[model samples]
Target: MVLKIGDARSMYRKFKPHLLMVLIQLGYTFLNFITEASFNEGLNPYVYITYRHAVSGFVMLPFAYFLERRIRPKLTWPLFVELFILSLLGVGFTLNAYFASLRYTSPTVVASMVNVISSLTFIIAIPLGMEKLDLKNPRGMAKVIGTLASLAGVTLMTLYKGKSFRSIWSAPIHMGSSSIHENWLKGSILGVASCITWSMWYVMQAYTLERYPAQLSLTTWMSLIGGAQSAVFTVCVEHKPAAWIIGFNIKLWSILYGGIVCSGLIIFIQLWCTKEKGPVFVTMFNPLSTIMVAILAYFVLGEGLYMGSILGGIIIIIGLYLVLWGKENDEEEVPMRSS
Candidate 1:
């Protein structure tokens, strides 16, 4: 049976956000590996982040110029300041903090920390008056439960491996107790900082889009500003010229993938998503990355998938459903409530 074009367009409109988010998470799964490899090879996290945003800034600048020039909002001093602060919160602080944490700890630790961002964003949103919570309502309860479930699922995935699967490598994924070495505490702290800054970025991005309303232009501005801020922060602490130098290697690949796919394209998509949906809605999919990482690790790295990982992935999916369901119900009620 053939589908009508109008019907297909309707379906696309409905599922576009979900599909884009899944693609973004898949891109990030590779990012987890590439960035870690680059770090392992002694790439400075600060320098890498600076280069990434700078590359992303340039990559996006032309698109913003050609596409958004006619409709773009006037760049007032106030709006420029807002963009600068947003960039500082989004990439300038979060990326460096996250990569710095990655330097001191395993990606698993970082992933676990990231799973809590939805909850953090929800909490921040309430006080800032972006979200409403009425525990008596099932809709509110669903959001609360979903956040808890995701946190539980990620914790389970990170800490437990009930059984190992026989993969192509037939090798068991051994999560060592001592994998997180010296400065583990420091890394944990930094990871937590990244989550907080990232949540703030989401909230701020939502607010910024309301004012500016041009996703591509804002992405370009934020990228350039974030890169400049990160460069300044890096230079203040990291003065070693040798560390900043790079050639055609894994480091360059990491920067390109992160800049082009992750930041340049994905950041623009995320801003659009956050504008269409609320900040919490955009964050609700964070746990899916852990599941994707597990799948990719099994196939690409030959890491064995265990019972805990399987269970965690299932719970994460269920939790994500609850969040989305509640969000839809809330939206449906908004008009009725207002009337």
Candidate 2:
């Protein structure tokens, strides 16, 4: 009985990160839907993102200071430089592009396209020597095939917008400008760019995490630096002071949710997951968010669900499973090979 209990504990420990990531992605799905709705209400994307990072930075700073006070390593210039680059890729540019894409496309579209990050991360990892791809190995082959399948799904979703299945329920609040129509092509490109930058961020995070093991401190730094960087862009683009104002409206709600949940909470959870599992492991769960977004967007926002999206989502799921299976197999082999 003791042996069996130990085995169960071991299994749980191994799978915990994966489970946590799935839950995080689900939370992110809802967050993304709300953010898209906010964007539609005339909220300037740059201003919104700037506030998000600032809030996230402030929230994280205290926790980082308190929780990681003792164990925090000495701040070095090289680390500072890395954090700056991470801020640019992970928070500033990535989110700015992401919110801008939402202005052009639906939340579901952005979520679906973002799944390409998993594939992109996997590919980039190989070149960085962070991931090994041996064609002869079944696991490696599965990874490659899964990456291709996900990319294909992204392509289908971008190219084909079949008949719309709009929901009966209307959004409770419609506040923003409705001037922007859906430009699938431009949105898709920007979405793809966001994915790439995000993937790069993941890779860099994994690399940096090896040296700086303090997750909270790292996240705090990233948020603070990224917020400052984003502020510059916001000031340049949104010259009016009125754009930054957050009253008791959807805009306020959006910034609070984004700053607290998306940036503050989500970044910590992701950093923890990445520390436990590699960046690829964390990324592979992105497709789950796509499905979540599709459902939430359909019901809450009354967004149209197209046939192509359905089919593409299905393909992405299959690919996601393939990659996960491959990773599992690879991990199982590690102990055996070592022994």
Best by the TM-score measure: 1
| lDDT, candidates in the order shown | 0.86, 0.83
In order of appearance, the predictions have TM-scores of: 0.92, 0.91
Candidate 1 Cα outliers beyond 4 Å, as residue runs? 1-5, 170-181, 337-339
Best-matching candidate per lDDT? 1
Question: What is candidate 1's TM-score against the reference?
Answer: 0.92
Model 1: worst 10 consecutive residues (lDDT sum): 171-180
lDDT per residue, candidate 1, 145-185, as tens digits? 98888888998998899989857664343322333346988
> What does each candidate score in C-alpha RMSD?
2.9, 2.5
Residue pairs with backbone overlap in model 1:
none
Q: Which stretches of candidate 2 lie over 4 Å from their true place?
A: 1-8, 161-177, 182-186
